[model samples]
Target: MQQDSTSKDSRIALGLALTVRHDGHGGVADDLADLAGLGAWLRAHPGTVPDTERYRADEPDLAAVRAVRAAARALFARAVRPGEPSPADAARLLPVPEALRCLNQAAARTPTVPVLDWADAGPVLRREPADDRADLAAALAHAVIGFLAGPDRPRLRACHAPRCVRYFLKEHPRQEWCKPSCGNRARVARHHERQKRTA
Candidate 1:
């Protein structure tokens, strides 16, 4: 396993941005398409999106989160500048300034209170939502901010294999595509292209 000291929330930001994935059938799939889907996604990420086990999701919350996702995706496109962005959102990306405003607004939606404590390791400080009930959009936006501004920012990459629309952290020096399967697909596609040219 690749050892990384990145904070869980920062990693969670990448997860949040990846909620929109390429469906195997040449289309994009959104995990937050409905309240049920949103609820399930939240439940899957326990502590990061707290209170989701019994939490009731509504249309407004879903809409808000989708908006946050748009902003995150746009900023992700900016992060990979000079490189092609994920084809999934390439044509639909919001302007960088608008994306920035949207993300900032969502992040500020929830007020956080800092807490200080002593642990076995040492004194630690953390922040908690003021109301104790976290805003889904705010939490995700915060994570997006953390990941994009953290050390791993430079490692973010968009996979370009046929019909694949995903972003991943480049794990090693030789890494190219997001996964080995993507590499295989790319190589196969390249072979086909070479054959076509020769034929």
Candidate 2:
């Protein structure tokens, strides 16, 4: 109940965005990281870095991504509301339905993870597909979406760090931070607190 409607929507949208990027590419791999970067950039909002070599910062597509993020955030806000709304209440929000539809579609197609071709001639020797970079990029996004909407929905969560804009799935219910580093940072701060108390 305490979760603000906007926050919930943002969390869900963020979850969807993150879901679309989990292509098993790796931390620094081009294909994988580009999708991940897009997810991060979406949450960050303005001043997004759209690498042309990777995702092509063309006007229409980039605008589409930005709009999607905005719609998603708005959708989350609407989703966490406490009750049913009147007809007039529905009239007040136009984009919510479309946004919800997008999320639903993303969720519906959300797969566990994409199967890699792994037959490419890259230095890494992974099989690569003949699809162009943009298609591959789209595939990454689609895959992320599918996984999030799948059976593992509950694991999705926003970053616990107040100002950080990131989303991650909790491996455990008690997990509070987005990344291990964030958790460790909190732990180290706590260690100093305990030390001061003992002293």
Best by TM-score: 1
Question: What are the per-residue Cα lDDT tens digits for candidate 1 across 106-133?
Answer: 9999988999999999999998888977
Error of 2 at 195 (Å): 14
Writing each residue's lDDT as its tens digit, candidate 2 over 1-199 gives 1234233333434543443222233221221134455555445443122243344444444444544544444443344244222221233233777865654553333233344554466433332234333332233334334444454445555443322334454566687776776677567778888999999
In candidate 1, which residue pairs clash?
Answer: none
Estimate every model's Cα lDDT from 0 to 1. Answer: 0.82, 0.43
Candidate topping lDDT: 1
Model 1 spans > 4 angstroms off? 1-4, 118-124
> Per-residue lDDT for 156 in model 2?
52
What's the lDDT for candidate 2? 0.43
What stretches of model 2 exceed 4 Å from their correct place?
1-57, 72-98, 101-141, 184-199
Worst 10 residues of 2 by lDDT: 23-32
In Å, residue 191's CA in model 1 sits off its true spot by: 1.4
